[model samples]
Target: MLQLGGYFKLIELGLEDCVSDIDAQPVYGYALYKDGKGAKLFYPLEKFNSDVSGRSFHNGRFIQKMREKAVTLPNVRLEQGTVTSLVEEKGTVKGVQYKTKSGEEKFPMALWQY
Candidate 1:
């Protein structure tokens, strides 16, 4: 899928596979998935006192640098969901039931045919 300006591979969709042609973030947010664990894109919100000094507390300078260079994160959406069930018909993999922000919606989804 494409996002912002880059793209990322949707290795899997929950447990039921779903491939998309739309820009990733155009559909969802950002996060990371590995080893069956889910991680969200969030950095710590630091606090500073008026007496504090040294490096700037907000180190968003890195993000600023990337923006300056026109470099950006890949287009990937947070698959914020879990597979509830599989829709099968006559032993054929038909569709999937997944939970999104819109609750569970089982639409006819097939990659090869999509």
Candidate 2:
């Protein structure tokens, strides 16, 4: 049930539209640890392959698409503020407390927190 809900959220977050291609090939490479001190890796979103990679979309592209879709939703409102804390009760999140330019505000997220 939780997995299904997560799939729906991905759709709501515009995962389909953000993905420019679904058949992109994977870039074959591995992380190299130089002298057992530093490591380097070059994995870009465009080089992702669903057949090989665990993640479907590149994180940055996914985030950009979600933000674009969020603005079009009637129920979802974009808030410009720094989140101070999350309200929780009985180990469940109930709301989010954030500070805006005008004042501090509390927005209920009980329906989605679980």
Candidate 3:
């Protein structure tokens, strides 16, 4: 898990520091049931040891943290808008057209290149 986190630069971004016991919890496993019967299956995280574990977190907070970190980087723009359409060229997506409070805007894919 540490190696995977490192690959995504989570360590460099100090994302681990954002984890709090209040929002992040350890989830050992889950049970599913149907028709008021006992759990049909018991899925444990430890069984898939190398892939993922029993860890739970608040998605909203995690996304907020990512957005906060993203906006701090050069050439990064965080806009509050709804994507209206895709800008396609030669059968490929080139950019996006979005609507904001004031007006509509076009964000080309080229602008995303760093």
Candidate 1, 30-74: lDDT as tens digits: 588999999886332245223122122122543444343333336
Q: What overall lDDT, based on C-alpha atoms, would model 3 receive against the true structure? A: 0.57
Query: What is the Å distance of residue 65 in model 2 from its true position?
Result: 1.0
- Residues 1-114, candidate 2: write the lDDT tens digits: 113234445456556444444332334334576666766564443653343332344566656666777788777767677777888899987777777878867564443633
Error of 3 at 94 (Å): 4.2
Q: Considering every candidate listed, which one attains the maximal TM-score?
A: 3
Prediction 1 TM-score vs. true: 0.24
Q: Candidate 2: which stretches are off by over 4 Å?
A: 1-15, 21-57, 101-114
| RMSD to truth, every model | 17.7, 8.4, 6.2
TM-score of each: 0.24, 0.45, 0.52
* Highest lDDT model number: 3
Error of 2 at 92 (Å): 1.5
